[model samples]
Target: MKLKVTGQNRGFSILVLVAACLLLLSACSSGGNGSNGAATSSQQSVANDATSGGSANEGAQSSEPVDIIWWHAMGGEMGRAVDDLVEQFNSSQEGVRVEAVFQGSYDELLNKMKASFGSNAVPAMVQMNEVSSRYMIDSGEIEPVQTFIDQEGYDLDKLEPNITGYYTFDGQLYAMPFNTSNPLLYYNKDMFAAAGLDPESPPQTFEEVYEAAKTLTKDSQTGIAIAISPWFTEQLFANQGALLVNNGNGREAPATESLLASEAGMKIMTWWKQMIDEKVALNLGRKTADTKKAFVAGQVGMIIDSTAGLKGIVDSVGNQFEVGTGFLPRPADGAPGGVVVGGGSLYILKDATAEQQQAAWEFMKFLAEPEQQAYWHIQTGYFPVTPLAYELDSVQQNMAEFPQFQTAVDQLHATTLNPATQGAVMGVFADARESVANAIEQVLTGAMEPEEALQKAAEEIQAQLERYNMTNG
Candidate 1:
């Protein structure tokens, strides 16, 4: 049977390598800070010994809690929220103890996973980035959450489909959606009104965005500032119902090609380049932080960024000017599409024993409960993956106060479910994103035309795909 939810209401606010990882977990566990750190072998032995050396009733009575390490990438305030959740789970029941260890950025964490693969010291649970799914699935080191869902007859109907869609591959759910977010068009209403544009009508298409930028460009303020990353390019493609990879975005089978040179891709690159040339759009380098700073400082009229930054941005903007939010700009003439989710999910590892695996599943289910999801959204800006969280009083109050929050949820629900929107999954996705970013830069700097740049990117990605499929085959 599942443990009951034990989270309390608060004021509307609320991995290491094998050897290196061992040191970190020992320190965390020793402190007894309730984060119960890594699953050290000695710790595992204690639990095992507790159940083995006594009478059946005595063994049952002396049942030691299963300890599981949760490797994560969230840091700063988000990292603290993670710690709080771990403590809550540790206190909620005696079945499992979760120790969450911050292991740097998503890329860094992925690198660490690669380094620790054969050591048998990998964590029992990991909060992996969305794009890392392809590689993780190929690694054969994870136990699909689908296994638990089927074993326990877990009903997935209560979870948000938009968030779950991205992790569902081969008719199986690979991970538990957590801390999900999407992109949003955030514009300064004051800037819009000053430009003689209707504040209520933010740009809805690329052309409209360009025109708005042109009108908003004057003095020190530009019309829009977007960090040129492959993510935005992917969003533009998905918004128009275009696939980034073949074979149903690798869901039907492992993808063999990247469609970065498709017509839709060309249009996106061309428009992005056109904006940079026209001087209305600010070509901030691939740091959304720089772009956000510009927007908050009132130097840019509009910007596009992850909904995960929604609360921070709004709070930073503070009473300086009103903020308006809209769906990520889509092509006016293209088929209906929607933005993809942009956060990590909790994954259970096969390195864990059966008991530890089930314990980890319980923790996953606890986090997905409506109350816990609402608390997560309240404590951090991450949108909830459980739709029922929206009905909670705290989340509703938050949405009412910051309608931009609602705009994000609405955009997600409004999206049409399709392979493109679910997004592309390829083993070298991280490398491919960098290649696409470089291709965009090449076009923006006039070193290559849109077609040539995208073609080059596609070729690089396809070549990598061939190698990855062969190696992992």
Candidate 2:
């Protein structure tokens, strides 16, 4: 009997949804959406001070309470977790009160943020997606986290390096890492055992994955289900020590063009095409929800998805079949590459009073603490940004109950810090990702060969990058 699994959106799709929301918001907020000059002036002063390494709190802690707004895109259980933490922070102190506001999804939140610029309604702090790091940094409206760290002399060593690495640029931490996640190979233990494969050891390389898929594909069940997403494709490239864009994956300097038609890119596209040709891997298009559904319904034996979906998959699978997880597969060469961090980070907006910024920093520090980090990890299945959170009793107990959760942590720890692993920082990343998805779809649907599809996509992306660089410059 197959387990009836309900589908959920993960990673790349969610980012796309956010981007769409941003567009919708921009359209809605056009015309008469007025600005507050006074607020904008105050914000500019505070931001200037912060950028100049001035203290976050020049004045003493006020006798009265300070209320600040935190706009976030988290929903469902994760939303509830945010509420709980806010309540804790409010109750724990009399100096600050944090108002947790849900501004739709990450895309919507960003949209609202853009619309709120130069207005008093702008949030004091906002949760921005990881992919938006480049845009956010270039926006010139954010007070880097390093400002607070340097001013307060906070201990930055407690945070996980891999998680922090994604938000760091030019040796400065631009944002506070939050709700970090990485991709993993999720498989069915029962299916593997029945296929005469060792359930204890999952495939670690692409070649092994292909052979296992061959044996696992038998009757109605496909061996693997993977969504044609830029996130997964990015991981494949990074694992092969390949650069997605020029200028050290956009870390050393601004990226001018994509390298999707390079040798490493060809290797990935070839493997994907071969898998679908052999009927071993199901072509799920760009819908991550469909891939999740296929895996849950036992229609496919394995999937390449983010660790963020672990809780939902476990809950949906129930007692039907045991779920197993392993690090994402690498190329046959076994190159020393690593996965990039997904999920969003917290950014303290510059359009706020110094008191509000200080209060926001307090809340930020609170969230990064071990206790809060552990609670968040246990509740939402996001990796704790701090290593100490893993040592917490709650995290340890949860890990024991669901050992699958440890795979992502292990993968993150093993990942070497490099430009490829840091991921591409481009202003037109959303468009670039969409283009890559389209290219993969073209290849899978037999409309174009891998080389042709990748080449076309890379050219389009390059054009967009040039336009963006011109405008932003």
Q: Write the per-residue lDDT of candidate 1 for residues 1-473, one digit (tens) a residue.
A: 96343354322222213667788878756733222234445444444442333223322232467778889999999999999988987876665678999999999998887776656677878899999999999999898999989976899999998889999987899999988888899999998998899999888998899899999999888888899878888888899999999998887899998899998898888787888898988888989999999999999999999988999999999999999999999767877888888889999877666657767787888899898899889888788888899988889899888888978888999987899999889899888998999998899889999999899999999999999999998
- Summed backbone clashes in each candidate are 0, 1
Task: Tell me the tens digit of each residue's lDDT in model 2 across 158-251.
Answer: 9998889899999999999988888999999999999999998999888899999999999999999889999999998888777889999999
Error of 1 at 117 (Å): 2.4
Report how far residue 147 has shifted in candidate 2, in Å: 0.7
Q: TM-score for each prediction?
A: 0.87, 0.87
How many pairs in model 2 have backbone atoms within 3 A of each other, for residues 3 or more apart or on separate chains, i.e. clashes? 1
